[model samples]
Target: MKKLFYFLFVLGIVSCSTSSDDTLENQQNPTDLEPNKAFVYYMESPKVSSLQPSWYYTFNYKNGRLVKMIGKFVKSENIWSPDNFYSDSFTTLSYHNNKIELKFSNDTYPTIVYTMENDKPKKAELYNQFNELVTVKTYTYESGKIKIYSKTYTLETYYTYYLDSNNNLIKSEKLEKSGGLDKALTTTTYSNFDNSKNPFKKLYLLNDNFYEKSLSNNNYRKINYTIQNLQNPEYLPEIGNAEWTYQYDLNGQIVLHHPL
Candidate 1:
C-alpha cells in the first residue's frame, strides 16, 4: 500500500557501512560532512511539528571528520532540560589508516569498523567488547552512492538505494533473503525537493536509523509504499496522496533545524 500526506516530520537516515585495500585512504578519502563551515552542530531526531519526547544529539568534528556525538538531553512533555542522556546515546569515532572505528557508550554493542571510498562505505566489521568478531558487512556502490548494503548478524537484511542524476536519493528498498529468494519488504520514495543544500549530505555513519529521504539535495516530499502481499504477486492498495512543503531560512539552511 502507498501512503502519503502532508508530512509532519521527515526522517533523515544516517546510514551505516564495508572492506578493501587501504594504503592510500588517508590521502584519497573524501572530506567529511563539515565543509564550507556549514556545520550541523545540533540535530533533533523525529523533527515532528508536535511537541513530544525527542532525542537531541550534538555533533563534533575535527579536521572535518565527525569525531564524536553526544546526546545532550530529551524533551519531556513541556519541559526541555537535561536529566541524563538517553540510553546508548554517546558515540566516539576513530579515524585510522584503513577504516573508521565507531564505539558506542553502551557495552552491549560491537565496535563498527567501516572502510570507505569517496566518503561512502565499502565494508564494515563488527567486534564485541571482548574484541571478538561478531559479523561482517559489505556494500555495493554505483556513481558514488551506496546501492546495496548487506548486513548479517542473527538474520540478514539487505537495502538498496536508487539515486537520480543529481545524485539525490529517489527511492530505497528493504529486501530479505528467504528460501534462497530475495523478498522485498518495503519501498520508500522521495520527491519534490527544493534546490537547496541538504545539511545532512555526506554525514554517513552518524546514526543507525536511515530513511529514503535521509540524504538528498534538499528536503523533499516522501512517500512510502508497502507491499500488501509481495508473495501474492498482484496489486497493492493505494496510498493517500498528499502534498508537503518545508520552510527554509534565508541562508538556505532548513529552518526546521537548530544549532547546537
Candidate 2:
C-alpha cells in the first residue's frame, strides 16, 4: 500500500484545507522562528570517531501552537542522556476552532484528530486507548489540490496532491483498493525551491483557529528535491533516488534537513 501512504503522509495524519484571514499574524517572534532544538546525526565507521548524534528534538510553543514535543537519544558525542530520556515519549497538542488534537504520552500511542470545513481540512480521526475509532481520514478539494481518503476496516488508501502556483506541494500520488480495483502504487515529484525558506511555515502559523488564508504564503516553498516512483520497482531501490539539504536560521527557520 505504498508503504501505507508513506506512513500516513509522513505522520501529519492526513487532512488539508485553506482559507482564512482577519489581518492574520498573531504574535510570532519567540526568537523569530521558534524551532527550539533538533539534532540527528549519523555516519559511523571507524575513522576519527566519525560524527554522532543519534536523535534529539525539543520544542514547545503555546500562542504559536506547537504545544509540546520532546525526544532524546544521543548518548555519546555531544551527549544527551537525562537517563536515556523518553519521558513517556512526549507529544501533546490540542486546539479547537479548526480542530486539532494530538496526544501521546504513550498510551500505546494513537490519538490524532483534525477537522475543518469550508476553510479546508475536513476530517481525520484515529483514536484508541479505549477511545475506540481506529481510522478515518477524508479530505477533498480539486483544482486547488489535495485528495486523501484513508479508511480502515482492513484497508483503503489513496492520496494525491499536486500544487504549484506557489501552493508548493508539487506532486504526489498513491492508491490502493484491491478487490474493488484502484491500484497504482506510488509517484512523487517535487523540485527545487527555496524562495525564502519554508519548513512547513509553522503549520500555518499557530492557531488563529489554525488559520490558513490560502495557506498564507502558500505553504512555505523550500523543497529541494524528492522523486519516488515505485510500483514494485524491486521493492524499494534505496528510495529510488533522493537528495535534499537545507539549513537556515537567521529567521528563515529550517535549521537543517540533510537527506542526501
Candidate 3:
C-alpha cells in the first residue's frame, strides 16, 4: 500500500564527523525523546497551516559511518487506511564505518558495485537487473560535504536542499527533465522557531490553504499553570497564563497532542 501522512522529522544532520573524545555528557542523539531533548518536525502548508509531529530518528555510531537508522511513527488516531500505509520502503546508506556492510537481496550477479574513498562514494558501476551495464554516477565533495557531480544515465532526476543560517533547511528543489519544461513543486516558508528562549514553543501553521486550518493548525493552544502557596510557590496569574499543555509519554514522546 502507498504511504500517506507519514510524519518525518530531520534535525541536525551534519556532514562532518567529530572526534570520539568530544562527546557531550548528556547529549541527545536523533533517537532520544527525553523532555530535555527531543525530535520535532512541522509539516506545513503553503498558506501557513501546519501539522507538526515530533518523531525520532536514530543512527548507529560505530566507526564514523551510519550503521543503522530506526525510529517509530505515532499519532493520536490511526491515520493509516486501506489505501495508505504508515511506512514505506526504508533505505539507508553508509560512509566510513566498515562493520555495517550493504547486502542486496540478490547478489548472484550484482548490478552495481559502488567504489568508496575516505568512506565517501567515488564511483558506481550501474547495471540492470539482467546484469547489463546501465549507467554510472560520480560524486564530488565541497569542504567535506558530498556533492553529486554527474549521473551518466539516460534519465536523471536530482533533488537538493538549501539551508538557512540556523542550519535549518529553508528550501528544497527537485530537478527533473521531462517532455519540455521543468516542473518545480516548491513549498515556501511557513513557521519560524526562536532558538534563544523557550525551545519547545507553540508552532503555528501560517496559511489555511495547504492545511485544514481550523482543525490542523489549532492543535496547539495556550494554557495556565499555578503553584499553590500552601505547598509550592505562590501562584502567579501572569506566569500561569503563558503556559501550554500537550499529551506526552513518560519518555517525553508526544501522544494525543492537541490544544486543550
lDDT scores in order: 0.56, 0.52, 0.33
Query: Candidate 3, after superposition: displacement of residue 58 in Å?
Result: 7.8
Model 3 over residues 160-207: C-alpha lDDT tens digits? 434444444333333443343343222222133222222122111111
TM-scores of the candidates in the order shown:
0.65, 0.26, 0.34
Best by TM-score: 1
Please say which candidate is ahead in lDDT: 2 or 3: 2
Model 2, 134-223: lDDT tens digits are 888888888757787887776788877777666766666666665555544656555555555443345342221122212323323222
Model 1: per-residue Cα lDDT over 1-260, one tens digit each: 12333232222221111223233334333532343222122233232333223444556766556677665333455446433446346778887755788887765654888886665677888878898877677888667355555555545667777778887887777766656565546666766777766656434575543334455656665455654345555666334322344456676655433333
Q: Is candidate 1 or candidate 2 better by lDDT?
A: 1
Ranked by TM-score from best down, the candidates are: 1, 3, 2
- Cα RMSD (Å) between model 1 and the true structure? 15.6
